[model samples]
Target: MTVSAPPAPPAAQRTPPAPAAPRRRRPIAPYLMVAPLVLVLAGVLLVPLVRLIVVSFQKYGLDQLVGGRPSEWVGLDNYGEVLAAEEFWSSLWHTVRFLVIAVGLTIGLGLLLAHLLAKVSRSVRVIMLLAMVMVWAMPPIIAMPMWRWLIDQRFGVLNYTLFHAGVLPTRSFNWFSSPVTGWTVICAIVVWGALPFVVISLHAALTAVPGELVEAARLDGAGAWRVFTAVTFPAIKPTVLIITVLSIIWDYRVFAQIWLLRDIGANKDTYYTIGIWSYVESFSNKNFGLGAAISLISVVLLGAFSIFAVRSVLRTAQAADAEADAR
Candidate 1:
């Protein structure tokens, strides 16, 4: 054999990529499965959103809807009109006030309830929880009228009792007659409706607290108050934050109670929020543009709140997860 490299075997041909593992097609599978849901959401939500945006620029009225097309684009005129109006600003302030009072009271009451419920026997806890849930489960319409009846001038049990007990001069004091009083009643209704959920969430979170950690705190000469502040409180702080954010969002969108109160006698001009204002402008005044603009503004404010809440949640969750992983 010639010592010359026996005709060097051609470099073994690279086996072509092992056929790419049959291209396990999964990414597009998830998308295909979700396509129906995407279509449904687009039809229900996005379509209306697009129309609302368009109408926010166009002039549309009930009569126009009956006989014509949207004729003109007002550019920023609708927004300017809303911003320049005093009621718009007033309504926004009222909404913030309502949210602060309602959410504060709700959280406070909920925390107290959760704490109390945690110490009670199981039977008693269930009874109390069921009672609270009854209030929460009641529809706003039902609760609104019932609360109104309770505060009614002549027959309201509240005023009647106050008068009979000599706390009031007469039974003629109507809670919804004054804006401040009406607002307070509305806050109470909202708190009553919202507190149950917070209580339930917080109660669960509290129960999840490690018993050994609590025992250790107690053995360390920590008083009940100190143990709560240092251990139990910190553990439940995230739950409280979530509850507060939810309550704020709920109170901000409250319209049924406020609207019913307004219908009963509360001054629309005095007791208003972005929701009520948008409704009145859109339906009563036939100002779709103004209504949409007001709604968009409200959405912007809510979006900001949601962003803050989400960021807070992410931070807390990340911290908890890190702690868990470290353990």
Candidate 2:
């Protein structure tokens, strides 16, 4: 062009992202909003906890309670007795065993169901979700009774079906005759009740996994288990860990199922777990101090376990984060 094209004016200076709108100041409103809940928890949980520890050191039996006399401070006697008692140790053993079985089955079955849900069509998923929700919504109070009926010696559907199917030798099997069989049924119910929650939680976690990652793994010829362990599980590891911790805590404190079954004449002493032992000691045995001691011990043990669990969760999360950043 004859006259070198008029020089283009320099572009206007770009705004520097408005200084990133200044880092947001976290508002105090949220803290204030939760203050009421904190107070309520203090009143309900903290007050009872303090009372429990105080009573644990004293002989707080029904005699003292009814006689209007101050409790005798027994110091370490309750702890020594509890530690030496065979009943306490037996209860602990049963509790630990049941905890392992229930939590394991619940987590395993739940994980399987969650993956199945992911692969199912929308209608199938909806139906499965509705079924789980129904089961989950049923209170243990109601659910236990239903389960008891199913396993009842006389009119139990379980016995009828098993007898017909030749799975059981007799038409009426005494499920509660031995600790092993009784516990098997009890564990089944516990696992059943616990599965819905686990499945739902895991499904939610699974839903968050990136489709691209899954597809890439498949494209690279990873089989189902390989894909799960490599691409899918790593993504949901934090959720799984957290759920496992929760399952441990909840399963450790199981009481209602055993109590209801016992109340209906399931068995005596055979089915006693730690929670049942605590209740029996407190009310039935009228040894409140011992019960308090047991509860305090349980609280301490649980706290220790919770600490370990929290550490695991944190460690895993940190590891995952580092791996992600490395990528």
Report the number of the highest-lDDT candidate: 2
lDDT of 2 by residue, 1-327 (tens): 587887765667544444556778899999999999999999999999999999899999998879888899999999999999998899888888998989999999999999999989999999999999998898888888788889988899999999999998998788888788888888998888888889999999999998999899999999999999999999999999999899999888888888888654556897887788888999998999999999988888889999999999999999999998998
* Global lDDT scores for all candidate models: 0.85, 0.89
Q: Estimate the overall C-alpha local distance difference test score of candidate 1.
A: 0.85
Best by TM-score: 1
lDDT of 1 at 234: 76
C-alpha TM-scores of all predictions: 0.90, 0.88
Residue 73 lDDT (model 1): 83
